[model samples]
Target: MSRPRCERCLRAQDHCLCPLIPHLQSRTRVVVLQHPSERLHALNTARLATLGLVNAELRVGEVFADLDQLLATPGYRPVLLFPGEQAQALVGYAQEGCELPFMLIVPDGTWRKARKLLYLNPLLGELPRVTLGQVLPSRYRLRKAPEAGALSTLEAVVQGLNVLEAPGCFDQLLRPFEALIEGQIRAMGRETFERNHGGR
Candidate 1:
């Protein structure tokens, strides 16, 4: 028989992280533009990130017809978190003390799919783009990143929130993410995981 699953976290009941994860609200709002295909990905952390925030929203689409309305939420400045040559690092801006509350738009998908979210949605492209400054190595040991400094969606959001708000945001926000990775490693066998992720 198939294991029971938690409809909310989408994790099997044995691995459900909901009870252990606490809800956190921030001054900034999270808006995830998730690819439809990533909805069921085992390692997807976008949902975890969204669940942590009180003023967060998750919208799935290749091109959002109502993106303009979403972006135009009064009293919040929409900022797209995408790194590239054209994007500005957020650390200095935070230090400079920009006063507007940000509506953070994060695209959840593969590199190619994330880029498509930017291109297909004209509104996303026009938003102010920001990136993390010198991210530490990702803690997602289960899946190798395509390149160095590539963080899971949850990591990026946590770091971004840290920049915009204060340090230590990562601690509360990463609890669920860390739990998911640990559960996966336990399922894979602790000895095998330790041999690879820890010194033998």
Candidate 2:
């Protein structure tokens, strides 16, 4: 039989993270485009971010049909949170054309899958790209990051919002994410975690 789960957090009922999740409001609108395969993963931090932020929305799919309308949000400039040669650093990014808040579009998936999302949806590639100025070490100890600056979707969103709004404004969003990481560590046992992850 399947274990019972929390409807909101989707975690096993006994280990629900709902209590740690905080409801935060941000000036920047966050839209997370998640790959469908990751929708049910145990470490789906993108879902946690969506649940914690009032202005955030999560869409699971490869090719988004409604992306046109979604990006048409008024009074906010749309920018993709992705890294590339031309990606502008978001730290102190000057509002050249208009003084509008940013609508941050984040793609949630592995690097290959995220790239596929862009290939399937050409509009995503056309958007202005922004990268975090500082690449902090990830708190997700369960999985090794694919690259040096790679971060979990939740961490990326939190850092992005901090850049757009005030520094540390969205730090609360990490409460549940950190809780989840700790829970995973406990479940795997301290010895195994330390052996595999170097306890870093």
For model 2 the local lDDT of residue 52 reads 96
Local accuracy by lDDT, each model: 0.84, 0.89
RMSD of each: 2.0, 1.6
Q: Residue 53 deviation, candidate 1, in Å?
A: 0.9
Error of 2 at 20 (Å): 1.0
**Residue 148 Cα positional deviation in candidate 2, in Å, after optimal superposition:** 0.7
RMSD of 2: 1.6
Cα lDDT tens digits, model 2, 103-200, are 99999999999999999999999999999988778998888888898899999998888776755488888998888889889999999999999997
List candidate 2 segments past 4 Å from native.
92-98
What TM-score would you give candidate 1 relative to the actual structure? 0.91
